[model samples]
Target chain A: MTSRGVRHDSMRARNLAVVLAAIHRSGPHTRAALAERTGLTKTTVSSLVADLLEAGAVTEGGAVRGGERGRPGVAVRLSGRRVAALGLEVNIDYLAACVVDLTRTVRLRRTVRADNRNSDPALVLTGLRDLVKETVAQAEAEGLRIAGGALAVPGTVEDGVLRNAPHLGWRDVRVADLVELPFAVDNEANLAALGELWFGCRDADFLYVSGEIGIGAGLVVAGEVFRGTFGLAGELGHVVVAGDGPACRCGGRGCLEVYAGQDALLGALPSVSELVDRLKAGDRQAMETCERAGRALGVALTSAVHLLDPGRIVLGGIYEPLFPWVAGPVAEVLEARLAPMRGAPPSVVVSRIGGDAAVLGAAGLVIQQVIAEPGRMLGL
Target chain B: MTSRGVRHDSMRARNLAVVLAAIHRSGPHTRAALAERTGLTKTTVSSLVADLLEAGAVTEGGAVRGGERGRPGVAVRLSGRRVAALGLEVNIDYLAACVVDLTRTVRLRRTVRADNRNSDPALVLTGLRDLVKETVAQAEAEGLRIAGGALAVPGTVEDGVLRNAPHLGWRDVRVADLVELPFAVDNEANLAALGELWFGCRDADFLYVSGEIGIGAGLVVAGEVFRGTFGLAGELGHVVVAGDGPACRCGGRGCLEVYAGQDALLGALPSVSELVDRLKAGDRQAMETCERAGRALGVALTSAVHLLDPGRIVLGGIYEPLFPWVAGPVAEVLEARLAPMRGAPPSVVVSRIGGDAAVLGAAGLVIQQVIAEPGRMLGL
Candidate 1:
């Protein structure tokens, strides 16, 4: 009898998850539409929606007009005021925090520029903590309850530990220990990819290339980041682009980072803004530098495309601003190298969210948990 | 009322699938063990097992004693004799077929050497058809029923249509139309990886490098082949290893295939066998040729490792025979190039299945379908 009761409960939970996922993905949906989408009966959908409404996870959103000459149905949506997720990101030069409601609306956002490289971990983390605390308070003031938080660090993170952030000169830092909130930590590139999936293009599979001081990529497959077996996937910066080019800090020759990383670009220009301005003014030197970087990036990305075969490639961070100058060379090299038999080349686009992608994606991590197990978040 | 009935049937099917998967993965289990593993009650497991027995999908073995002097329980296993799957392959130089029982035991295997480059699709397919027919007849003679067949071709395949086998000079050939069987067709590399998963190490994620006249790769993630958006992932041969080296047939400079492909190796020797013999005899020219190829392969593979981060890389086809000479340089470059932050390098191993991986994998595909929907296989 106990086993049967457990089985029944699990079935209910599974049904609840399905209904929640359907509404979350294609929301403003009527019960009838949800039933059709999830293959649940209308009655089952109604019962689940009622349970979610009572749990404050969902709310009715007026009437959704049916097709012409048909009766209208009441629309339902995830409740924005009931719960929120906090996102935090620590980059070499900035610390950012954001709170997003259940409907993925930004309730609070804060960013501060501080050279964190070579700084004490305690000092850097303290600044980030203050920002997160402020955001949490702001979100609560907006009548939103914080469900959880997640941190995005520019480094190799595993199980909430920031292991070896080369750019920040930090190693083996327990991120959760520094922040008082209950939070999950992941690599910034990984979160950026998730951010794109959640808020940007919502592509089922693509490579999210995050360009900062160094270039990294996040492999997203079926709407989830494809973290390799040990969470060490998508390290695109060090992919050798030229066998005999310049040496890279990673102790490799002709790495993609050496050719296209921010430091490399800056070596040829005064600043990124200046470089962009010059390019816009049709400066020959700036154009040549950007084009060379683009081609090298294309060379490395061609390898990525061949290996992963993503449907699209989203350029985030610095690349987003540099895309116009880079896209042509990147496409030319990719077309030249990728097998003609592969039909069309994968689409490459600039990230819509830009620098905020990692922080927003960090919030998405919490939202993902709530979606996976709404009962836990609802305390049911 | 009808919807409730449909839901109930689906629930039953789901439970049946769970039980079947458990047995298939870790079989020869007692009813109690199945209950513990599947989280189903002993009574529920017994009933499901009984149904499976009635459907001839499972059979009881002799009772096995439980640990620590407990009462013995009857052991159950899949009924291997009740079903079989056929596998077929069309390579650049060979056509092969294999049959395997549900227990993954090969019942019949055949391979015929025939250069298929620039060959007429109809004639090549006819030769393959004859080989498959002989294997099917042999399997039936051994008292096994052919569940289905899958064909492995070396090129881009989409929905059983060969879009372009550049090596074979074939285009837009519908494989199913060429064969009269309830069959599925896929790229040779994809099948080889699946074959490795089903019969070799069974790593949840790995890159299976298929080294033939041209190089290809199969990316497997979480026990399934990761075919990119359009099924054109894993074109590893075209990955640029040298930016200014010789031009490749794929219209790329310094592609891995240009330096490591069979043609490249054969260019320096009489035959693969003779090259191996010369290397074994410590011939300087043979050693130099093999070493150069290994380094070039290493260079290309470094790019792959940085991008995908597969848990293991299984060298298949020609690479298997040449692994001893190649593995060293591949490891050297991977270790030197991969970021130290990524922890240890992925394990590299030669495929244990050797040349028969694709054929066995083709058979495995059919078996996989049966395992996924055992009810259909059992005529339930």
Candidate 2:
């Protein structure tokens, strides 16, 4: 089948990307192991590794023993320090940015609080642009090249456009048009899930629920975000928890948002942290609110478990800090309602990346692109 | 970059399977198209197609024009009639069996109604075995060879074992031991969804809700049944529709099953068809019951759409004939509740395969295996 008329350069480029992916996803492999695993010849593996090293996509270290055969051999791993990406986020209450490298590690992070609700999209983009540019300069000063970038907006993003952000009162905001960097736009929850998948969690399949002013979730199936046909897969907040409970902003009754959204749980409270503080200080109302929110979340997740069957549910954003107060009730509802055989109900857990998951995940998306096509990133 | 010690026979066998899949997925292709799509040489595709024809896995026909190109050439298609599979189902009230072929076509079907509720697992399997044997004999007399088989039970199935069938009063029933065939066991809803995927519907992603004595769903994502982390993904019946509506059999409050299950929807009524007849006669009580059930189902699907974001929702089993009475209220709920940006809620539709979806889908599973590895089916 001698390449079947395929271009030699493109084949080599694909092989390079494959080898890089092998190292990035469970790496520190010796050249011999990579050759065997990838089914490429030892000579070809050597040539590709040489190209990768020259491109600073991978680094080879001294003999790394204690493996399948326990024979000492030089090890190769990701040299992600050389290439990084910028992640920008515009939330209702804040604007954030971070730099993530090829190894899927967060290298720099910063957040600034602001009253962004009902603010003009252009004004918000100006503030976000400043934050991202400064962070990119900082990352560059540390000797990292910006390979690609993405912005995580708390909205339904499609074709690099933020279609809507209810909390921010934004509609059809194209952040890329205003931002200086060539960053694409994406949904916040989706990026956070990607961040957890790439940087924090070891499991490939799980649900990452990002709790902000509005609750949204990212359905991660088979290691990729399960974006629906319309690319708007996870909108957990809108799922009806009670068929006749209460009126919701989305013209729905008894929606999870009406019960478990930040505003619902924290009325007039500045932040989730303050609510936690009140609960810790033995405030009965705060404790009741947390319990009620947890129960509502559990009801919504019961439907999610039935529909998606994710392995685990990671609560990110506001839910992360509030996990101690919420996870117990969520798990309780799951155990009682879910059929005993759906396997064990999905284990509820906190996002290890905390509130910064979305921003870091956005940067991780770029790093993913770089690792998936190293030749393209390195100009071949 | 040769074969890397991979066996020549294995590679050729894989190439044969690849060509067969190409035809089965989107077929009636000329040899040139097969070669182009599979990245195999024209000579290689010709050799593989020759082997497939020899194995009776494909049929070469007269010139079939009108395709991507209006050129005239002999077209290759699935010779599924040569190898068929037996699909058996054991639902709460009936046992069904069907024969499906490599082309995913149902050649024959039969159903026997019985009070399977609270019946002994052994007695039920015996009846099912007899039905399957007769179906196999009938299919054999029609010149079709049974290559493989599977059983769809109204319960949880894992590793060819019926772990539990609550409606059937069965637990740990290993039907393969009694059925004199190499029949695998699977959940009825999962098989029904697969049946719809392979034989009825063109779309790959959908939620096939099988409304029976107990409502269950098959979550089809990326053309495969998404058995959750625990292989019990589409337990839509147990998904909380009303957080505090009523105590359910699963010991949960406000489960969709409590409101939408067969017994709940029909009560003293005998069957869904009877209810439809009553509704046609303008029976006020019947119409009210269906509307209420539709509202409850709509509430459950709202959660499903928000979490899974399936492109479509297919209601099978009893819901097929009942679609006229229920789909309106379901659509109305979706239109009212779902966030406008989640990209228009999933369109609700009836199952094209009618009530026999599970049995047919079960057979399609075996046909899929045959197409995937034609050599194995041919005892290579």
Q: Which candidate wins on lDDT?
A: 1
DockQ of 2: 0.37
Residue pairs that clash (backbone atoms under 3 angstroms), model 1? none
For model 2, residues A69-110, the per-residue Cα lDDT tens digits are 665678999886687888878887789888877777778989
TM-score of chain A of each: 0.94, 0.93
Chain B of candidate 1 versus the native chain B: what TM-score? 0.93
Model 2 chain A worst lDDT window (10 residues):
A1-10
> Judged by TM-score, which candidate is best?
1
Instruction: Report the lDDT tens digits of candidate 1 across residue range A169-288.
Output: 999898876555557999999999989988898877889999988788998877778776668778888887888778888777898998889987767577788778888999888888
Stretches off by above 4 angstroms in model 2 are A1-27, A31-55, A67-71, A110-147, A173-184, A339-344, A369-380, B1-22, B25-27, B33-48, B67-71, B110-147, B172-184, B339-343, B369-380
